[model samples]
Target: MKQKIESKIQVKWKACNHGLKPQACQHWLKIYFADKKVDELEKAISKAARDPAKYGIDQPALERRFKWTRTTMTQVVEYTLQAVVGTA
Candidate 1:
């Protein structure tokens, strides 16, 4: 199921006129994260946001890549989780 979703995202991404813009990326990310299997990962990420060291998450690297502070990133993760779970 995951593979099928990934393939579909990839195909749609390739066919997207806007290329890899943020909107396109976010659309795909929402679709991918909506999978039931991703629920576990989202929960782990939410926990990792609170305790990066315990989760082996490189906070600085993620901050650099996202250009967001840990707090902002945490909120983003939580929001995404809620959206995916249909609770938002």
Candidate 2:
């Protein structure tokens, strides 16, 4: 079930013009849930942290590579959080 939701997010992300790779989406989800203060999406966050090659980012280089604005990034995070928590 978790894998199914992850795949759904990947497909939705690809369908949109986010101009980011699947890894980037995974990274965003990780950062948002890393210190969420709630138990929501714990499994997903743990999985992301366990695989840096898949979800980790170079902090210094992200500014140059990722084009998303803070507002847009927040929106994605909120959307993902809602999807995960609301569905569960």
Scored by TM-score, the top model is 1
Stretches of candidate 2 exceeding 4 Å from the true structure: 1-68
RMSD of each: 10.7, 13.6
For candidate 1, give the lDDT of residue 25. Answer: 67
lDDT (tens digit, per residue) of candidate 2 on 39-74: 344444455545646877454444433333344545
**How many steric clashes does model 2 contain?**
0
Q: State the lDDT of candidate 1 residue by residue for 2-58, as single tens digits.
A: 354456666656645555567756675665554433455555566777877876779
Q: For each candidate, what TM-score against the reference?
A: 0.29, 0.25
Find the candidate with the highest lDDT and give its number: 1
| Distance from true location, Cα of 62 in model 1, Å | 25
- The C-alpha stretches of model 1 lying farther than 4 A from their native spots are 18-26, 33-88
Least accurate 10 contiguous residues by lDDT in model 2: 61-70
